[model samples]
Target: MLWVKAFHILFVVSWFSGLFYLPRIFVNLALEKESVSRERLLLMARKLYRFMMMLSVPAVLLGAWLLWLQYGGSGSFKMPGWMHAKLTLVILAIGYSHACGAILKKFERGANTRSHTWYRWFNEVPVLMLLAIIILVVVKPF
Candidate 1:
C-alpha cells in the first residue's frame, strides 16, 4: 500500500507538470503569428498532450487501486466525504485534460478563435484544481 501510494503521488505529480505547462504552450500558440513558430508550438502541444495522457493513465489507475484497497473487499464503503470531493475534482481534472486535447485539435485545424487571454485564464484551472485536491486530501475538510 505504501508503495502504491508513493507511485500514485509520483505519477500524479508527473501528470500535473504537463497539465501546468500545456496551457502555457496554448497561450504561446494563441499569440504566435509566424507560421513556422505556430507549427512548432503545435508540434510541442501534440507531443505534450500525448505524454500527459500517458502519465494520466497510470495516475488514475493507481488512484483507483488505492481506493479499492482502502474501500474494497467488504463492499461496505464508509469513505470520507473529503474523498468524494477529491474524486470529483479528479474527474474534473481528467475532463480538463481532454478539453485541452480538444483545444489542441482546434488549434490544429486553424479553428481556434480564442485569444491568448482566454488561454491564460484557462491555464489557471488546473492550478486551482490541484489546490483544492491537495486541501481535500491533506486537510480533509468536510
Candidate 2:
C-alpha cells in the first residue's frame, strides 16, 4: 500500500509537470508569429499531451488502487467529503486537459481564435486545481 501510494504520487507529479508546461507551450504557440516556430511549438505540445496521457493513466490507476487499499469494501471504496471534493477537482482537471487537446487540434488546423492573453489565463487552471487538491488531500478538512 505504501508502495502504491508512492507510485501514485510519482505519476501525479509526472502528470502535473506536463500539465504545467504544455500550457506554457500553448502560450508560446499563441504568441509565435513565425511559421517555423509555430510548427515547432505545435509538435512539442502534441508530444507533451501524449506524455501527459501516459502519466495520467498510471497516476489515476495507482490512486484508485490506494483508495481501495485504504477502504476496500467488496472491491469498492467509500470516500469521505474531502475525497469527493478532490475527485471533483480531478475530474475537472481531466476535462481541462481534454479541452487543451481540442485547443491543440484547433492550433494544428490554424484555426485558433483565442489570443495569447486568453491562453495565459487558461494556463492557470491546472495550477489552481493542483493547489486545491493538495490542500484537500493533506488537510482532509471536512
Q: Kindly give the stretch of ten consecutive residues in candidate 1 with the minimal lDDT sum.
A: 71-80
* Model 2 error, position 111 (Å): 0.6
Question: How does each model score on lDDT?
Answer: 0.97, 0.90
1-142 per-residue lDDT for model 1 (tens digits): 9999999999999999999999999999999989999999999999999999999999999999999999886699779999999999999999999999999999999999999999999999999999999999999888
TM match of model 2 to true structure: 0.95
In model 2, residue pairs whose N, Cα or C atoms come closer than 3 Å (at least 3 residues apart or on different chains), thus clashing, are: none
Clashes of each: 0, 0
Q: Which portions of model 1 show Cα errors greater than 4 Å?
A: none
